[model samples]
Target: MRTLVIGDIHGAYLPLMQALDRARISPLDTLIFLGDYVDGWSQSPEVIEYLINLRSSYNCIFLRGNHDDLCLNWLNTQQHNSLWLKNGGQSTIEAYKRITQPTLQHHQSFLETLPSYHLDSENRLFVHAGFTNLNGVNFEYFPEMLYWDRTLWEMAMALNPRMSPKDPAYPKRLLIYNEIFIGHTPTTRMGITIPMNAANVWNIDTGAAYKGPVTVMNVETKEFWQSDDAYTFYPNENGRN
Candidate 1:
């Protein structure tokens, strides 16, 4: 069975569906999702609902994202963080208005159960962001950093392409996992709209939360598929632009 890794969805459900159809996903394929499943568009509620149902028929591993955490907090506490609302939380809040109470509770339960990271038997690490510990994720001191930290990606990018892991200057964090997949930081920020590989880390968040498309990549072959720009899917809305 093929192992496919999907990038941050950010409530662009239509593009997500299109990307999946383009990829021709099979129920037997193992799908690893890097989170941020909500926020930034008009379909956050729909995205969560779809995912909850999709889990039953597929081998899916969902990781929690920073945005998902904020949404869960709001659902439980009924309070808002101004920064979150400004970023993409407002759109999620608006979409959730149409959802029934039981469905909302189910969404909340799903979010609550999501893991911060996943380590496959092949030693591939799938995390929404990155871990800080030199010893790796299991030793992480701050749990939230799993979905909030950018330092791991920054360190990977700073490594010299010619540098070997055996070299003294290599970052310890990169040495623990055979491969690391992350999605919190968009490749678009670096002036690209596709998956990026820096050292052993692969970033697949192709800016679906903003102007780019939803991306799905085969982890083994690196073959990928994308939909049209997510913003184009909702021309009337800005979508956290």
Candidate 2:
């Protein structure tokens, strides 16, 4: 079975589905989602529902994202986060308004249970955002850090490419895993939308939350598929910032 790593969805249900269709994801393939399943265009609830149902067909590993934490805390803890609302929580709230309580609660439970990172048997690390330490640290301690650290990615990018693996300055995190996959930082921010490679890290977030395609990549081969621009799917709506 192949392993596919999907980047942030940000409620673009159509793009998400299109990416999956383009990738031809099957029941036997393992899907490792890098999170941000909600809060963007108009289909946050629909996106969550699709993922929930996917459990029956695929081996799915859903990592917790910062936006996901915002939504979950609002739902389960009844938080009134102004920052989250300003960022995209309002879109999520509106989407949930159309969903039933039972459905929202079920998805909430699943969200709360999601791990911050997943380490596969191949020693490949899957995380929504990178971590501070790669020494098998449990996310239960710094739950937020696991899903919100940019320094981890920056650290990888800052690695002296000239340094040998045995050098002391080499990132300790990369040594712990065969390869690391992350999505919190969108490659579009760098003025490009394709999956970008830096050192041994791969950034697959192609800005679907804003105006790029949702991406799905083959973990082993580094082959990838992308959807049409997510904004075109909802021509009348402006996705959240």
Candidate 3:
């Protein structure tokens, strides 16, 4: 069974569908989303609906992104915050306005239950963001570290200060993982990178909800499939906000 790892959707539903079609993903294939499923676009509600339905048709693993966390927090209290409103949360709110029951408790429950990070039997780790400590610690106690830690990601990439690939201090070796798949940070291009020899961390965020394309990568084959169209939620300089 092949595993397909997708980057942050960010409400770019059409491009996501197109990429999925291009990959020829089957119902039996394992599909893992790197989160940020909502925000940065006008179709957050539609994206959520599509994912909820897609779960029935495939082996899916959904991880919570920083944006998803904000949405759930806002939905529970109805109070707006900078993190929520500034980063496309306003668009998400607009998307929810079309629904008859905006506060869907069940949806919130699903989002809440989403794992912070996923590790396969082969020791491949998948997370929305990067972890600060590579000491084989549980991400639950350090959610922020997993969702927004750039230092740890850099250390893993540099592979420095550790003399040997087997050095326990090496971030990659600490996890005892073969590769790590992460999103949240947008890349100018769509492809894979082996940042470290031992770790092989791959970042797949292609900025679909921005001015770029959506991306999907086959874990085993390292083949990348991307949509042709450039999907964007933000308007032109003179367009409406």
Residue range 1-241, candidate 3, lDDT tens digits = 7899998877777778888999999998999998988887676777787888889989999988888988898888998987668778887777787766744665676788888888898888898887765454373456666776555455655665446766655455345566888887766532332112224667777776566667889988888888753444344311112
Candidate 3, residue 8: Cα displacement in angstroms equals 0.3
- Local error of candidate 2 at 82, Å? 0.9
Candidate 3: C-alpha RMSD to true structure equals 3.7
| Off by more than 4 A, model 3 | 137-140, 159-169, 172-175, 189-199, 229-241
| Candidate scoring better on TM-score of 2 and 3 | 2
Spell out the clash pairs found in candidate 1.
none
RMSD of each: 0.6, 1.5, 3.7
Tens-digit lDDT string for candidate 2 (58-90):
899988999999999899878789988877788
Q: Which clashing pairs does model 3 show?
A: none
Ranking by TM-score: 1, 2, 3
Give the best candidate by TM-score: 1
| Model 1: per-residue Cα lDDT over 1-241, one tens digit each | 9999999999999999999999999999999999999999899988898899898999999999999999999999999999999999999999999999999999999999999999999999999999999999999999999999999999999888999889987899999999999999999999899999999999999999999999999999999999999999999998889
On TM-score, who's better, 1 or 3? 1
- Cα TM-score of candidate 1: 0.99
Cα error of candidate 3 at position 14, Å: 0.7
Mind sharing the TM-score for model 3?
Answer: 0.84
Candidate 2 has which clashing residue pairs, if any? none
